[model samples]
Target: MSPPVTAPAGRKKTLSHPKKANNMPRQPRTFKAFIVLCAIALSSPFTTPATQNAQAQQNRAVQNQMQNDPDTGSKKGWWSGLPREKKMLYTTTASAAAIAVWGLATWDYGSSSGFHTAHEGAFEENAKYGGADKMGHYFATYAISDMLTGLYKSYGYDTRKANNYGVLSAWAVQAFMEIGDATSESQGFSWEDTMMNTLGALTSILMARYPALDDKIDLRVEYIANVRIGGIFDDYSNQFYSIVLKLDGFDFIKNNFLKYLELSAGYYTRGYDTDEVKKRRSVFAGVSFNLSRFFYQKHYNKTGKVLEYLQLPYTVLKGSRDLD
Candidate 1:
């Protein structure tokens, strides 16, 4: 018989729709660079001396107004400022755009394979150290909720109520992302991931609402690098997680020099899904600066405040044990 014909090289041929596989449902490799660029761009507007003075003056004016007006001091009510109609319109438009963007990004974009689905519960088992990627989701949601909590507080919302708003906002974003994941052929929706996200967000909101826990504890993430073929956040392997407890939160150390110190406990896992190295988990106990209680006046120190929230660049000391 004559030789059977085959599709030409360097091209994909299909009569029906192409299978939406091979495109990983994860952040782009350039994500870190993208975040750095975004930070620089966002802060550039306040760089010039004139702009600085203007901003400082504006902050002072707002502070003065808040100080003077008993009703408008600090935060406004949930119903304050923008009209509800405009808020709804903006929200609807943003949600639509987000869905569209997700579709474009995930429907096997730039993938080398076709769409394929797995048997139920097939991908869920032994899903790489309990889907450590879920930690990424948790941290992301927590950070967003924390930011929104601060913003809502700055806008003068009642503290507890503002925290609720932050939680809801984080939950909404998580829902959108999770829905996208559920639809992807290359990946399945993970309940573990969702629960971790809730746990992360709850910590942020609860701290915002109670204030006492905020005074005592700090949840922080540290990363190095992770590389797995099908891993979420595969580019970074050592995403160390930590919770710091301020000694000053207790009366015994509140008046002593120890007030400036904090004790942190952290966990990290490495080498998952790799044949060259064994999967390892590490437990960490460390010390970090407890600068949250530090007071500043006469300046709107946005940069310092942000730095205080982050562990800062290169200033942590730790001891660890590998739990093989």
Candidate 2:
């Protein structure tokens, strides 16, 4: 046995943060934008004529219109539904949601006063820069739209029309926030944020319109638990260090067994709130499970449905690594 065969110590290879090497000038939310662009490219050709498609799917039984039908496909009056008390309850609940979003937009945030920064081309600097914040925007927009769709569906709206109203409600809140940020003395509305939000909302819409494709993929996010709440709004480190998954892309067996498994690659940023730690942008890869997949009978329904709004756990503990 060659005992103690210790070689002379040479220069040790130090592990460094990845952001230093690939520090390209990214426009706020650049990675999400790239992801959205790729989704769009793979979705379908952009040449479909909207008017023609609309006419092709026009209501076939418009001649036998019912009195209880909604006035328009996308909106309804406060008193349009049955049971006045239920309608009022729905109205109140919906209004509360809107008000909550308003409060968030108007929050002072207590940061350096660079408010109302809607100057031309100013978004280049303020647009979250594809950091953890972009993941929040994406997750929220997708989640909210799905919730609204369910709310509208409960009120007896058609699937297409309900989805439209849901998208509208989600975008309305997002738009309000963006406008507020634009006018903020401390912050400017960021095109980067806008891009991610739009992509998220559009994802819900696309999923709603295409049930087949929605069955094949699942979009989900997870947060690492940390002590700092970082106020009621933004948590750049723990909350923002989101694990986003575009799951179940590889079902090699074509059976439902592999249908719930997924692959994930995500961005992580260190020390955004501090000046002390060297801000090293890192990337990670991992595998996660759609818990619902194990109990297929329960979640057999596809996306764009109300029940899909529940943030199901990526239950399985699996492997992950920071990319070099």
Candidate 3:
């Protein structure tokens, strides 16, 4: 059946010409349906590519804000210089303690029996199994600690200063060992050891340099475990354990047991070797003891807490328990 067609609004109702009467153009059903569909598509709220991109950008901006916010991580307070006299006193004490402990422990191993047994086997074993080939594990560890402690004192614990203290420490260690190589007739240094020490120092320095960025960066703990592993050999073991015990104070043994336990946990956890044993061994082998130094500084001095207590000046405790 044919449908009746309507004429244009301004056209006459009937066409007089034969050509116009039968063959006049008419809209197809397909074309009419397409026009209706197009109108519906245009009216929809579905976003275009540009709008989607804008929305994606907004999401990324939100994520960035959450990541960069200071609240997401801790920050150090303004610079507080360590008093010169105090710094000198602490440095002298720390150096003396370190030297005494190293000497006493190494000698206790019976390596000091006229020929230096402590240096022979331990040094050999460290050279073979340890990541670097030159210096023995103990020597390396001592050197690293000494260098880093010097860095801490040099900066006076100022967090405001750029934190390349680690790198500075590492370089110092390298330089000192190399100088030892040149100067010491009995204990000549090896280039291999020097290079390895450099590598290890770089890792510590870089980590310390970008502490904020490196906070969550986890490495295999076993790499530093060499410090504890020395315990397997009785002489070295006693020395380390005794030092830690003494640091807690002989009088306060009971009170400091928990602290000692925590130190042990740190030593073990960081030293446990898995896949990271190889990589971290080279990087962290000599520097593990520095962790102990860090602990001593933070806890022993209680610098932050001391500053806070000083700032209050006891006024806030006017009616407090201490006053009572």
Candidate 4:
């Protein structure tokens, strides 16, 4: 072989490095206006007279219960005297503030020259992370609603009020985040994300109104270890979005061995972080032991609660079909 090549006498040689995969920019904040819209939406869940009349009767029953319940009258904490709406406002505001700070510090919020919009294809096989980000939006709002429902109930709000406030709070918080994204240099407001957020919040309300449904189905995220990208929430390559149906939810199955099993359907993407040319989107069906139910049976309630939203790896035996 010939001698190794070299730069000309007067020129300097430059070294080239492999390019890094671009992480999707972090995602929001017209809160006051959005709150008005949320209120209008919440005020009318049904349009027909018969359904409206039924809802009115239900509301009156809830009010009667609250008026008669001794626990509702008890003063247990410093904020007990505050109105439930004010409590919800304060809590929502605090959550928004925390998210704003996080966005500013890590997501470069307000660094853009002006507000903008981005068209992130929703659940399209070719979209970024094969639409894992959309699932992220859905999961975030759904989880937030569930947590806020518990909070509102603890604050003495009745079931309907608590469910309504939870959805409202979750929607408002997500809308604020999207508004912030509009101002970020590396991110833009995404209508698809907003739509997913709404779906998530609505699902939460549906589950709250029907405990049996909640017990039967779960929307969850599963994370497997991989190279870090931005943060855990931003690590799409390692994450899977799953919709699980638990046999334990059925009365007959609950008394049999099948109760310890669960079926899951999910979507995930691969090679987005390091190999765009070979990126793949896949849909999967899986069977997994009901670890959440196991935790509940062991009386590890807190662990069970966490498992409800997060699927532990190595627990699922899955088969996947590539979308592209």
Q: Which one wins on TM-score?
A: 4
Q: Write the per-residue lDDT of candidate 2 for residues 1-324, one digit (tens) a residue.
A: 000000000000111221213342111222232233223223311111222244334434441343356555335454653653465346435644653454345333222244433322211222222245665566556655655554455454656776777666666666655654554333455565577678878888987798656655555444344435343223344332233343444435566656666555555554543343444455656665655344334533232122122233343254444322
RMSD of model 1 against the true structure:
12.5
Superposed Cα deviation of residue 208, candidate 3 (Å): 3.3
Q: Which stretches of candidate 1 lie over 4 Å from their true place?
A: 1-81, 84-96, 99-103, 106-126, 129-131, 154-156, 225-234, 254-256, 273-275, 291-300
Residue by residue across 77-178, what tens digits does model 3's lDDT show? 323234534544463455345433532342121221242101212123232222212222222322233233333433344322312442343345344433
lDDT of 3 at 113: 20
Ranking by lDDT: 4, 1, 2, 3
Query: Which ranges of candidate 2 are over 4 A from the true structure?
Result: 1-106, 109-115, 118-130, 227-234, 239-256, 274-276, 295-324
- Give the whole-model CA lDDT for all candidates, comma-separated: 0.49, 0.43, 0.28, 0.64
The alpha-carbon lDDT assigned to residue 144 of candidate 1 equals 54
Give lDDT: candidate 1, residue 218.
68
Per-model TM against the reference: 0.65, 0.56, 0.29, 0.74
Better of 3 and 4 by lDDT: 4
Colliding residue pairs in candidate 1: 19-115, 20-115, 75-155, 75-156, 76-156, 225-236, 225-237, 226-234, 226-236, 226-237
* Winner of 2 and 4 under TM-score: 4
Candidate 1, residues 1-324: lDDT per residue as tens digits?
000000000011111222334433333221232233225323322122223467567768976987889777436756445653444345334644654475456444223233322222111323454234555556555655655554444444544665677567656756654455455554434465567668867877677666567657766656443454443334335456678787876766646678878888877656543454566666789887655445312243444234333454345688989765
Q: Looking at model 1, how many pairs of residues clash?
A: 10
Estimate the lDDT of model 2: 0.43
Ranking by TM-score: 4, 1, 2, 3
**Which portions of model 3 show Cα errors greater than 4 Å?**
1-93, 100-127, 130-156, 160-162, 166-187, 211-213, 223-324
- Top lDDT model: 4
The segments of candidate 4 whose C-alpha lies over 4 angstroms from its true place after superposition are 1-77, 227-233
**Candidate 1 or 2, higher TM-score?**
1
